[model samples]
Target: MSEEPTTPKELSVRSLTGLILSAGLAVVGLFILPVFRSFGLAFRPAFWLVLAIEAVALAGVVISVLTLHRQRTLD
Candidate 1:
């Protein structure tokens, strides 16, 4: 059977939530790489700045997951 083509207008809430979740994961993954290489710089202000941003990304991931759970229960 042929799958129906998905248009922007047809996108479901679950798909959008998944997209947000994926984006948050990617951000966290990319941000974490610098931490491993910047051990010497860990005491600097820049390291803490980056860590704060990473924490925000992590929060986003958590929120998106909760949103998915709510959607699943509603369905």
Candidate 2:
């Protein structure tokens, strides 16, 4: 049997931190934004910020999943 000739790139500390932050932002957006909106006190900027954060979090999740799939395939 033959294995892959190269190793996959490891995620850097900064990159991992950013991913964790993104996931946190996603949780805030998923859980908090609605409550704010429900209270009817949130402004336009808050809404936009939450949306942007959620988008970034979603992107991070997609990238992470794809990377795991690639690594699995290599294995």
- Find the candidate with the highest TM-score and give its number: 2
Residue 21 accuracy (lDDT) in model 2: 73
Error of 2 at 61 (Å): 0.2
- Cα shift from native, residue 53, model 1 (Å): 0.5
Tens digit per residue, CA lDDT, model 1, 1-75: 999974333335774676586676667666664675566554456556666766676776666656553322323
Give each model's clash number: 0, 0
What ranges in model 1 sit over 4 Å off? 1-43, 71-75
Candidate 2 — what's its lDDT?
A: 0.70
Q: lDDT score, residue 9, model 1?
A: 31
Q: Per-residue CA lDDT of candidate 2, range 1-75, in tens?
A: 998788666655555666677678788787776776777756786688678878889898766655542332444
The runs of at least 3 residues in candidate 2 whose Cα sits more than 4 Å from the true structure, single-residue gaps closed, are: 1-21, 31-42, 70-75
Residue 17 shift from truth in candidate 1, angstroms: 4.6
